[model samples]
Target: MTMRIVAGIVISAVVGVALAVTASYALATSNAPDREVEDAITTGNLRAGVVVEYGTR
Candidate 1:
């Protein structure tokens, strides 16, 4: 009976961890496009500024 209880606790913990990881990954992918857009705009502006500065020299 004690072994069965321990086994049940271990199984529950593994399942809980799996659910948490899956939920976080789902949330991250869902929000990824906004992050990509922000990054692209910042990188593009930086690159353009560098190019113009070098071109002027």
Candidate 2:
């Protein structure tokens, strides 16, 4: 019975970590911008952070 409880706790911790990682990646992707837009702002072949788009039409 003790072994079973320990196993369950370990499994739950692993699953929780996985879920947290997945959620973080999803949020990161949503905030990230495309490569081209980033290039225009930096004026170099650099890439990072969110890329915001603006239009005058």
Candidate 3:
């Protein structure tokens, strides 16, 4: 019974770590961009100032 409890705890910790890592990776690799900027580009209304702002970043 003690061994079973220890195994359960270890498995739970590993699963929790895996979930945290996956969530972090998903956020880090996201391709979504700013909606307003995307709309401006799509409509051919993008401004020079916007480009400069992004460039400085």
Per-residue alpha-carbon lDDT of candidate 1 for residues 1-57, written as tens digits (9 for 90 to 100): 999999999999999999999999998889677754686697764644343333232
lDDT of 3 by residue, 1-57 (tens): 999999999999999999999999889768677776787789798656554345432
| TM-scores for all predictions | 0.57, 0.59, 0.53
TM-score pick, better of 1 and 3: 1
lDDT of each: 0.78, 0.84, 0.82
User: Candidate 1: minimum summed lDDT over ten consecutive residues — where?
Assistant: 48-57
Q: Give candidate 2 regions above 4 Å deviation.
A: 35-57
Clashing pairs in 3: none
Off by over 4 Å in 3: 31-57
Sorting all predicted structures by TM-score, with the top scorer first, yields: 2, 1, 3
Candidate 1 steric clashes: 0
Superposing all C-alpha atoms, what RMSD in Å does each candidate have to the true structure?
7.1, 9.1, 5.6
* C-alpha lDDT of residue 1 in model 3: 100
Q: Against the true structure, whose TM-score is highest?
A: 2
